[model samples]
Target: MTESSKSAEAVWAAEPSTLLRVGPHFRLSDVDPAATPGFDGDEADGKRELRRTNSELADLQERLWAESRFGGERSVLLLLQAMDTAGKGGILRHVVGGVDPQGISIHAFKAPTEAEKAHDFLWRVRRELPAAGMIGVFDRSHYEDVLIHRVRGFSPPDVIERRYGMINDFESQVEQAGTSIIKVMLHISHDEQKRRLSQRLERPEKNWKYNPGDVDERMFWPDYMDAYQAAFERTSTDVASWHVVPADHKWYARVAVQRLLLQTLREIDPHWPAANYDVEFEKKRLAAS
Candidate 1:
């Protein structure tokens, strides 16, 4: 590895302790979108670190898969929640994309269909939970019921308030059942969001990504921030803690998330299972064949 590569690895390797960690006292407004916590390196370092982290994550994911095939029940779930244009898609593309598809599952939750709306808010979400030995990515998750519903008044105050506890209970149950949860909130400045939205309009290829309604939603930026604060207060729990990732610098956000995944997987420490059959016998059988 080059000097830069080594430095980057060191930075990422220490992230679990050095990075900003969300807890009950966490406040969204206190985070600086421009700040690159736990990583003092520049964009070049971040890019290089991302490559290394991706390879490590891919290897870990494969190990987790192998362990499951041999009867391990543990898995990982990465729940990503962010405002529009806050780099969730970028993280999915640049970070999670490096892992094996069979070992990872991605679910992008949008406005619920009528049939989905008929059931409890979490019904659709529960159905999509990742199985043993896989990494599940929720592009937008059950938090939307609280976020959008709270912001737009689609649900009454009591209902919105109740869903928070429900979400916490749901996550706790899933965690106890062997799925490790890593919840992340991508933090970006209002100005940064506007710039990204403008870019979407300016570039022909990005036109499809832009929604005029996003401008309407921007009108409620403060409301959304308040909603997010409420969410962190109510739903960020020990079983499924939230990590607020500063996302003004896309490169930094991507690398930070990669580091977070590495940390989570390292903690899980999925090992290769011993062969159930006799290794020597299998080797002899193969030789004979």
Candidate 2:
């Protein structure tokens, strides 16, 4: 095998969660969106590794679903938070698409509706939690209450400050209910985001993704960074930790996230449940018939 392939194999053999997980003193500013961290692979190698692991990912997902059907209470929730053009859609279409669709539920949160705004921010979120034995994905999660609300001043400063603790409590509750949360922030550079936005404008096929409000949000990039940094400090808890993946390189980001999922599933270690009924009795009855 080529050296790059050897390196990629080593990455798979190693613990990716240790490399990517957010620590108590983690700083979003310290992350470089272009760096690959634990993987020494190039784009081609990364993509190949991602494909190579799909079967394992699929198998683990099927096992989780099977275990759930047999009264297993465990489930997994992958919360993806990123800026516009940070490739959240690509992660869903590529990484997540590799798994069985029946075993997954994906929810993309947008601006709250009139009815939704009438209740607490997490009220809508609770309704979308995945059932036992399934995997749940959130495109942009309750972090928006602190992120955009903090940047845009939708909520008062004190209210937004309170949400950090509230979110920690909420996540702890979810963990107690048997959902393992894997929170990831797709970190991208300012120039990379601008380049992606410009590409969308330049390509007729990508025009639909171009939003005028995206430019409006770009002005608050610094504020958003501060908000995310604060979130890392307050909410990256033992129940559910945050992972920052360098997303300037889409291939690396995809591979890193795939590794994260693999790590979590392996830890959960759901097995193909033992047959509850007698196989010999069923076979004998069928033969008699």
Q: Compute the lDDT for candidate 1.
A: 0.90
Candidate 2 local lDDT, 5-74, one digit each (tens):
5765675545558888899678788899998888866788888888899998999999999999899999
The TM-score, computed over Cα atoms with residue i paired to residue i, of candidate 2 is: 0.95
Give the count of colliding residue pairs in each prediction. Answer: 0, 0
lDDT of 1 by residue, 89-122 (tens): 9999999999998898999998999999999999
How far does residue 31 in candidate 2 sit from its true spot (Å)? 0.9
Task: Indicate the residue-level lDDT of 78 in model 1.
Answer: 91
- TM-score on alpha carbons, each prediction: 0.95, 0.95
What's model 1's lDDT at 116? 98
Give the residue spans of candidate 2 off by over 4 A: 1-8, 12-14
